[model samples]
Target: MLKNIFMLFISQGVNYLVPLILVPYLVRTLGAESYGEFNLALSIILYGCLFIDFGFNLYTTGEISKTENKEKIRHLYTVTIASKFLIFFPVALIIIFTVNNVSQFDNIKSVCYILIIQMLSSVISTVWLYQGLEKIRIYSLVNVVVKLLMLPMIFTLVRDTNDINILATIQSVSFLLSALLLITIAKRYDIYLVKINFSDIRSILSSASHIFTGTISVSLYTMSTPIILGLVNTAFEVGQFSATDKIRGAFISIFLILSNVIYPRINKLKVDNEFLAFRFIKKITMIQFFLGLTFATAIYYSAPYIVINYLGSEFQESIDLLRLMSPMVILVPLSVILSNYVLLTWNYKKYYLCVPLITCIFHFSYIIPLSHYYGAIGSGIGILITEFISFSLLLIFSLKSGMLRKIYES
Candidate 1:
């Protein structure tokens, strides 16, 4: 577990560090508006990648972990390829139409086009295969190398504001290279790319649909905010929201390293000693909460200093927005427990499906209005509210359904 966490930390550090380092540079060079345009295009690429992924991370990875039959593994590999190509055509068309038809995206249409590399690479990279096989070192090595390569490319090429397209292209190609590496290395598994019949494809998609919806719903809420802000407000406001969110999101991601380490562990634990795992989880929950509280307090008090010092004077308005979102740090770890551990451990997989739907409901009902009226600050407030609501909903639903009791009774 320590080895896995350490490896993940190295890879995740590279992933998180590059973007945070670029924020101040990009903000100063591109200014808020253009930087936000880059963010918006990136968001679209995110959802496009999400569509191609279709919950294969959890569903397919879980499937791969469940069995060792090479025939079955080969079949899973073939169907995954088939399913992604099946999903990709329509998604590409949608991307084409969205950039051409969507007025907000008119300026960065080139960025969107270049990001097709990113979208396609997301499907082909197959990090999930390593995670499933528990050969996590390979996954960590690939991500870290690509991220390091991207650092030099970004610094060399993205010297000016007009280079957002170049920056996007560099990032996309890094992903493509990573995918190519994965494809090359994957042959070690002796997996062959065979033709999957339509029935095989249908059964794969059918079994995976709920997981897919949950993934899409998650992308819709978390990744859609910047895009929605673009539709509702100017790109500058998206800059304000995204600037602070980048920091907050990165920190939350770092804290939840436990999630990746513990999740598959729980898969093993539940089989042998679920009661012990439940008790262990109680300790983890407390640790997460206190860590969250500490970060929240620090952000609330010091956002101004951090923003002004790290982000420069141009991002002063983000101080308030950052503070508004501070509490989110507190809820993230708890949410991870509910969503990643509890739901998966207790044979309540369907419960996991419903949480993101509720999050979407809160998005449309509360977040959109708040974003429309109050801009980024409103969006921050809505995030706080929805996060609390999600935490509450998951707890309440578990208790009501006796999943909570099952944990204690174990």
Candidate 2:
């Protein structure tokens, strides 16, 4: 597991680096206003993607973990693909028409369309399938290949064009290519593309309900920032916040890699060695805490220089937000891992309700208002507070449920 985590980290690390390297070039070329417009469109498309995902990624992973039956897995994959395609078309059309009819964000309509296409391709890609099966090598390879291909395209096209449409085109192409690569790999593994099983669709949907809600809530939290910023503040503000966000997001990807690699192992441990599972959780949590704290501090202190140097002087304002939100860099990972742990343990349903509920409340009640008043700093504080609340709640629940006690006894 550790080795896999390490490799996945390297893979994602490369992926993260590409964006960091590209941000400066893109920002300098596109300017803050155009960048803001681009990010807003991306945010809309992202939410669209999340809506279409419908929690199948999590559901499929959990299902795959339970059974290695190739036929069943194939059926689940086929059903998921068919269901996603069915839902995606309408969702994509609604977004394009609604946004176009509303006539808002007129400047970036084409960009939004390209992003929707990217989202559709992303769903078809079944990238999560590789993660579900613990095929980190292929997963990592695909990720690195996409990033490598993107580097040249971004440099050549984005820097020269300064056209948000071109940037969107590059993104769409990248998604299509990555999806194709994953499909090829899946085929090579003899994961046949079976026909859709509508009968199983109902079962899949029922089992996936909570996961869907939780995932949607999470996505809302993620995509809401740009939307809110775009609505309440100037485009420049959105650009600044989005730039800072991209950096923070890159750091958070490390934790994502850790959680993804560990989730299946943790699930297996829950079935095979319950006591060991608790101990494992404790150990990883401690390590995550220190790692989070260390990196948060480093980023907090270094953000000003990093932003100014990498993203240009126009984005220097991002430093304050980065510093304020740096602590969340740690809490976010801890919260995610704990949430996954809770879900895999006995109280799976409860796990879904806890964090997402708190997070949703936190966003609306505190984060949104604070961000409105204080700008990006307020948003950072809101995230910090949200993660802190989530982490505390999960810890309390774990202790009260006797999972922590079991670890101690063992």
Instruction: Tell me how far the alpha carbon of residue 331 in candidate 1 is from the true structure, in angstroms, after superposition.
Output: 1.1
Ten residues in sequence with the least summed lDDT for candidate 2: 343-352
Question: TM-score of model 1 relative to the true fold?
Answer: 0.94
> In model 1, where do residues sit more than 4 Å from their true spots?
406-410
| lDDT values for all models | 0.82, 0.77
Model 2: per-residue Cα lDDT over 1-410, one tens digit each = 66677778788878888888888887888888888889989988888888777877667776776678888878877877877787788788888886687545677788898787688886787855776787766778887888898889777866643468888988888888888888888888778678765777777777777887877776666678777767666677778888888888888778777766677777778889887877887788788889888989899889878888888888777888888778788878877765676544465567656668777777778766776787776766776776677778777877777666765565
Ten contiguous residues with the weakest lDDT in model 1: 256-265
Steric clash pairs (candidate 1): none
Compute each candidate's TM-score over C-alphas: 0.94, 0.94
